[model samples]
Target: MNLHPRIAADTLPVCITPDAHVRLMNDNRWPWLLLIPLQEHIEELHDLTHEQRDRFMADVNQVSRVLQRFTQCKSVNVAMLGNVVSQLHCHVVARDDNDPNWPGTVWGFGTAVPYEPGQADELLATVRKSFK
Candidate 1:
């Protein structure tokens, strides 16, 4: 299945699991990742079959653990809001009390801060290694 254009534009490829395509959000303010299921035309979680859902959840859990360990943040937030992009995807974000959007959601909280040259590459390498 092809990724939604918006997601493809905003994220960098990370790695793929059995059920989903993992990608890192371009923003550097938070350690955020997206898990997009590999099924076609799936706009909601309920659209996935039982086995697919299970696999997707496993992918989410794995990504969350990786983010938690890598960031050591105060908390990790996960959500699947398809309001803007109708494609089904899960967001796993690492949050800290000192973050700019502390005590609130990251959605539209502020403009994204782009990573410096090679910054995203370094992070992607570290995260990819952790998955192994």
Candidate 2:
């Protein structure tokens, strides 16, 4: 069986759930978080067992709460569309009306501004601390 590249690369930050991880997009303009369910064959929500599905939702809620508290975003946009990656993943983006893509979608607008080294460390620390 083929492995998800994400799992192999160990690129994203893992949460308490064994089957979930967080990927911080290197975007300074927006606080974007990717929640990936670590099941190997899950292409959709129904692909998960009922219990697994419930657990996924719990993870999503917890992440959303943390993002709201830390980012103080005007709105939190959670999406599960798999048009590009074709993986069962969720995007929890913190948005504001004043943002560049404000009142519009954040996808395909422009290149992502990679997070600065110091800021990346800080953001990672904030998320890690929140989970404790």
Best by the lDDT measure: 1
Largest TM-score belongs to which candidate? 1
Cα deviation in Å at residue 119, candidate 1?
A: 1.0
Candidate 1 stretches greater than 4 Å from native: none
Q: Can you write out model 2's per-residue Cα lDDT over 3-106, one digit (the tens) per residue?
A: 35753342345344554767776567787777777777677878889988888888788778888888788999999887766668787888888888897888
* Worst ten in a row by lDDT for model 1: 122-131
RMSD, every candidate, angstroms: 1.2, 2.8
- TM for every model, in the order presented, reads 0.94, 0.85
Total clashing pairs for each candidate? 0, 0
TM-score quality measure for candidate 2: 0.85
Give the whole-model CA lDDT for all candidates, comma-separated. Answer: 0.90, 0.73
Candidate 1 structure quality by residue, lDDT tens digits, 40-75: 999999999999999999989988887888888999
